[model samples]
Target: MTAPSGTTPNPLEALRAKLAAEPAVVDAAAPVVDAATLEDDYIVCHCTNVTAGELRGLIHEAGCSSLEEIQRCTRAGGSCGKCVPLLTEVVSIELGRAGIA
Candidate 1:
């Protein structure tokens, strides 16, 4: 392609080429996680504004092995509920990576 006469490669295309060359930095838009572990480790916290780190910490501190126990110990699913789905997704992804899910 002529790149629109005077223009360089499309900014997006250039960025994609750069990213493709670097395997260390994952594309934020596409998080990679295992499927089976996600099913077991995912937790939707509707309360306490908790994140994956908080959930993981609670799980570790409380010696809990399940999401339900995590909720009970940390009150993470006890709030506005807007972030619950995100929380669940983060937990699933992280746990999958950790081989715990």
Candidate 2:
């Protein structure tokens, strides 16, 4: 079946497109933490051995703005899916720290 007009081929792609189109309104006064400088040693997903640093890399470098995208890129929450919550938190923290929102 064909996708609806103006809609992306898939939800994930749609999300990625939307995120890419968004204007990053960073507060000039707020301190922006470089993703590379983030010292993320804690492992968020043990099933995949995905550390917080790795996930941050996906966000900062790979431009993954959502948890699903991160999972697709790194298989972090793809195993038992138990670490989805923590992964979500990590994504939020990294995004905020990086001043993406």
Q: Cα lDDT of all candidates, in order?
A: 0.56, 0.74
lDDT at position 57, candidate 1: 62
List model 2 lDDT by residue over 1-101, tens digit each.
34689975787777777888886786543334433354678677889988888888888887887777778888887888767767777788888877774
Model 1 C-alpha lDDT per residue in residues 28-97, reported as the tens digit of each score = 4333543233443344443454545566665555455665566577676457655544555565655555
Q: In model 2, which runs have C-alpha deviations exceeding 4 angstroms?
A: 1-39
List residue ranges in candidate 1 displaced over 4 A: 1-51, 59-63
Please report, as a residue range, the 10-residue window in candidate 1 with the lowest summed lDDT: 34-43
